[model samples]
Target chain A: MSELATLTLAEAREKLRAGETTARALTEACLAAIEGAAALNAFVRVDPERALAAADAADARRAAGEDGPVLGLPIGIKDVYCTEGLGTQSASRILEDFVPPYESTVTMKLREAGAVALGKCNMDEFAMGSTTEHSVYGATVSPWRRAGDTAPLTAGGSSGGSAAAVAADLCLAALGSDTGGSIRQPAAFTGTVGIKPTYGRCSRWGMVAYASSLDQAGPMTKTVRDAAILLGAIAGHDPKDSTSAPREVPDFEAALKGDMRGRRIGLPKEYGADLPDEIAALWDRGAEMLRDAGAEVVEISLPNTPHALPAYYIIATAEASSNLARYDGVRYGRRASLGQGDGIVDLYEKSRAEGFGREVQRRVMIGAYVLSAGYYDAYYLRAQKIRSLVRADFEAAFGQVDAILTPVTPSAAFPLGEMEGDPVKMYLQDVFSVTLNLAGLPGISVPVGLSGEGLPLGLQLIGRPWGEAELLDTAFALERAAGFGHKPESWWR
Target chain B: MSIDTDTARRIAGLARIRVEEADLPGLAGELSQILGWVEQLQAVDVSGVEPMTSVTPMALPMREDTVTSGDMRDKVMANAPDAREGFFAVPKVVE
Candidate 1:
């Protein structure tokens, strides 16, 4: 493996500034690493030409005295973000050959910050399932596997590809879109750091909408500082996104004071009730690590926690059904061939049926059912109220705690086909991380330890809305105390 | 409430995705199980809780009603599956 490919985004910026390495050298090293690790299937497409062109441009600008934060950084973009002239399918066959002429705000911001685009990462079709198995491109297996086990483990989803890419060193960092547990779960599974920023922190303009309200983009990287640096560059208010927060973007990297003295952290009693003993033990040890750093850890009550997943499915799927209605096959993407007497409605029906995969179709159906007449109040409205309670529960908890720490997932990465029997079985994986999206809070998953089987497990620290700076700081302290330094053996290649 | 194939067909129709008659039963079965799991939310006491319209508590910022962008007829129609006379072509709705 190229050592250049393994450098964190923060470390690479220093090397580039010292004239010790060129952007072209870093980009080419990542390209070489990507080519050598095809079995990972982390990237759906690798644009070496585009990557080289961008890197060369970055190098030129640096020589001209421009000092942007993310300048010369090589990153993988999730397929969910619309990268102009590059295929942005969101991993659905319906958009198999679809290429947007416009760019999503997040990617445009990354490019404007001088980041080089290595390629598009794979994800679940429409960001629906917990496993990436629902993708048209197939499952993105995690880089980590149980000791002595040869089975291919899932890297979690719908941000599975970005997590796998960062974990396997395919890029310095990658963009991940989180609606439910997409970013954090995958990061936990891969032992990389992923954060889902407070809702409205990142503009959704030009990104493929999953659940309009719940979906937000954040960074998945090898370390917390890299996450802070990359997140600062991409988040801000956008006139195009009406729901985007009209507030000041902070210097997130500077918040890494790394001192946990007197900071209050909450361990929600609702979490880990049903988790495996090892996961709960890892979480307990994480609390101990934080306690060792002088932070006051307390048992807090997020009383509405158990209802979060049910409410999330109802609300997110409802939004997804409405958002996905835009893909009617009249423009930009695959249009199923029709026969005589077929009208536009049939065209819409057939194209959608043929385009959406199993999980997506199921969610859309459930979404439509909930939103349909007679059930709207029985399902969607009640779920929205439950969502309000989920938020209120957090509001009450935040009254006493600066941040709440919980396990990122119910368990570590499971083997493929383990949850295929029932779709709800898969939905249960998001139980630990879904409530934050409902409450519109910022949450970061930092890998603190490994499961006994040897897969990485992460702890989540959720902060108040727009409180990512403090959240990242607490996570930084926890990370320092744990000093987790395990890497999966090179087995995929 | 368990959904029957008839209700599943109705949902697929509302969703605008075609489902075969044979597939409706399986789809209904899966949806029933999911909804059965989700039914737990119905027991929550939300009488005083309002429906959360947005995640963040920010007031929806309003902008003046004006066309900030336009005049890209070619760009607008570029991704159309079929275009006729600079417009998206579709099956005749009038019949």
Candidate 2:
């Protein structure tokens, strides 16, 4: 990788501002890196013509004295974000032939901000699985290999491709969405920073839906400062997305000074269950780091943590089934050919069955069952009640502390197919990360240390609803304290 | 409680996904397992709690009852599997 590809978005922003480098040069370097790193399976598509055109336009805008946060920056878009002419596949075969005539609001904002897109990154099929293995394009291999083993690990899903692209220096930053732990867990698996802002912070317009209530688009970047900058460019109210919060976009980049003075950080004991010794030790050190930075570290309790995963699955899959009901055969996407005596109903059934993958089908069926007539009161309603209790847990915790600190995942990235047989084991991957989504809050995973096997590990810092400014500020302090500089060696071609 | 293959077929019919007879058993087992796991929520005392309708606290935003977008006949029909006269074409439903 070129030195240009290794620069953080913040550093590149400075160089671009000072006329030290051009967006075309950075875009070319990143495109070269992406072309060479096809073995990583990070990017699903790379449009050099479009990327270069945009880069040149960014340069022209720079020359014309227009200034923006992401001006002249090169980044990757997740395949779920519709990019007009650029295909938005969402790593599902059902939508293999589907390309939107319109652009997703998030990508439109990025383009309007003068950022150039390298390509669309890969993801799990319909953002349903924990590993990118469920993707129609195939699983994205993590650039980071274990110290003694060369076996390729997973870059956690459904934003696995975005995480791998950023980690491998294929792009300076990338857009990733987190419904459960999609963004943060992958960022932990790779040494990157990912933040799922408050639920309604970023617009969901034009982006493919997965669990409408829990899904959020966030930035996967090399540092918290870059996340702040990238998020600032994309976060705001979109009249198009009525669920989007009607709030002013704060200057998040300006809020980061690496100062933790007069802040209270909470460490929930419930997250300590099933945690490995190395991760536990690192969690302790993370708290110490915050304490050393002049923050009051408190042992807080989020009592309903154990029920979070089960309840999250119940609610998420239910919403998923409803949100995914649009892919009927007649409108768009894959359409199964009708047989003799078949009608529109058969078209709907056959098209959906053939289009959706096993995991997606599994979740959709589970969702259908839960939301069905007989199961509604027993499952979906109960889960929603549990959702309220989960939010109550966080509300009470926030009353005692400004931000809560916890490990992003119970285990680091494992090898692909290690837990492939059972779906429940894979669901456990989001055990610690789902409560925030259920409660509609902001959370960031900053790489704090490496595991005993030399894989990168991250700690999550969750904030109250719409409290991303303080959350990013605390993450900056943690990033400064950790000084995580480990990068994956170029083992994959 | 485990789901039988018959119930699985019924659920598949409800979801509008054609599951082969052979796949029904597997789908039923998976659903039963997931539902069994999520059954833990039943133990919680949610007797008086109102089920959460939205994750965030915002009321549903409403706009004037006016057509905000339309008139792109070609663009609208662009991604359809089968279309004629700018309308989606499907197999006949009448008997």
Report the number of the highest-DockQ candidate. Answer: 2
Q: Write the per-residue lDDT of candidate 1 for residues A375-478, one digit (tens) a residue.
A: 99999999999988899899999899999999999888999778886888899899998999998899999999988899898999999999999999998998
Q: Write the per-residue lDDT of candidate 2 for residues B53-72, one digit (tens) a residue.
A: 88889799888999999999
TM-scores for all candidates? 0.99, 0.99
Off by over 4 Å in 2: none
* Stretch of 10 with least lDDT, candidate 1 chain B: B74-83
DockQ of each: 0.85, 0.86
lDDT of 1 at A27: 98
Q: How many angstroms is residue B69 displaced in model 1 relative to the true structure, after the best TM-score fit?
A: 1.3
Flag clash pairs in model 2. none
lDDT by residue (B1-95, candidate 1, tens digit) is 79998888889999999999998899889999999999888788988889998788777888899999899888777777788898888888895
